[model samples]
Target: MPYINVRLTRKDITTEQKAQIVREITATMQSVLGKRPESVHVVIDEIDPENWGYAGELTSVHRKRQG
Candidate 1:
């Protein structure tokens, strides 16, 4: 069995997008690790903008600065 954890800052990504990501990742894991998709566990974590940080700044702030 393969355990996968995916974390992302809270954003406007649609459910379809998330499902696609999960499907692709699961396929890769199944091929590379020889694990069945049904045996793989995928966890998607949606983090708060204030809690998720990068480059010494929160995600929201960082994105705003970059944009």
Candidate 2:
């Protein structure tokens, strides 16, 4: 069995896109890692900009500065 955790900042990702990611991740594990699709687990976590930060600043602030 394989467990995969995917974390990303909250963005404009659609439900379809998330499903694609899950499918791809599971398929990759099954094909390359020899793990069964039924045994592969993919978990996605979407963090809020305020809760997710980099370079000593929050993501919300970073996006504002980028604008």
Candidate 3:
């Protein structure tokens, strides 16, 4: 079984977009590794910007500075 994890900061992501992501990932596994679509697992994790950090600062803080 192939497992995929997608992580992103909390934002306006639609259900349709998530589904499309899952579909494409599964297809890629099938094409590249010969893994069955049914055996591929995709998990999406949405984290609050405040909890995600980069460049020595939180993403939420970074966005506010950009604005």
Candidate 4:
């Protein structure tokens, strides 16, 4: 079995987008790693911007600055 974990900042992501992500990742593993789709597991964890940091600052702060 192949397991993949994806982490993203909580934002305006939609259900369709998340489904596409899981499908693509599953397909890649199936083709490249010879894993069965049924045996593959993909997990997505969405974190609040305030909980995610980069460049010594919170992601929320970074996005605000970008805007």
Best by lDDT: 3
The lDDT of model 3 is 0.95
Residue-pair clashes, model 2: 0
Q: Taking the candidates one at a time, how many backbone clashes does each contain? A: 0, 0, 0, 0
What are the lDDT scores of the predictions, listed in order?
0.87, 0.91, 0.95, 0.95
Q: Model 1, 1-67: lDDT tens per residue? A: 6788999887887999999999999999888887888998888999988898788888888878779
Model 3 segments more than 4 A misplaced: none
Q: Report model 3's TM-score to 2 decimal places.
A: 0.96
Q: Mind sharing the TM-score for model 2? A: 0.93
Lowest summed lDDT window (length 10), candidate 3: 1-10
TM-score for each of the candidates: 0.85, 0.93, 0.96, 0.95
Rank by lDDT, highest first: 3, 4, 2, 1
Q: List the residue pairs that clash in candidate 1.
A: none
Per-residue lDDT of candidate 4, residues 1-67 (tens digit): 7889999999989999999999999999989989989999999999999999998999999999999
Worst 10 residues of 4 by lDDT: 1-10
Quick one: how many clashes does candidate 1 have? Answer: 0
Per-residue alpha-carbon lDDT of candidate 3 for residues 17-38, written as tens digits (9 for 90 to 100): 9999999999999999999899
Judged by lDDT against the true structure, how good is candidate 1? 0.87
Report the error of model 2 at residue 17, Å: 0.7
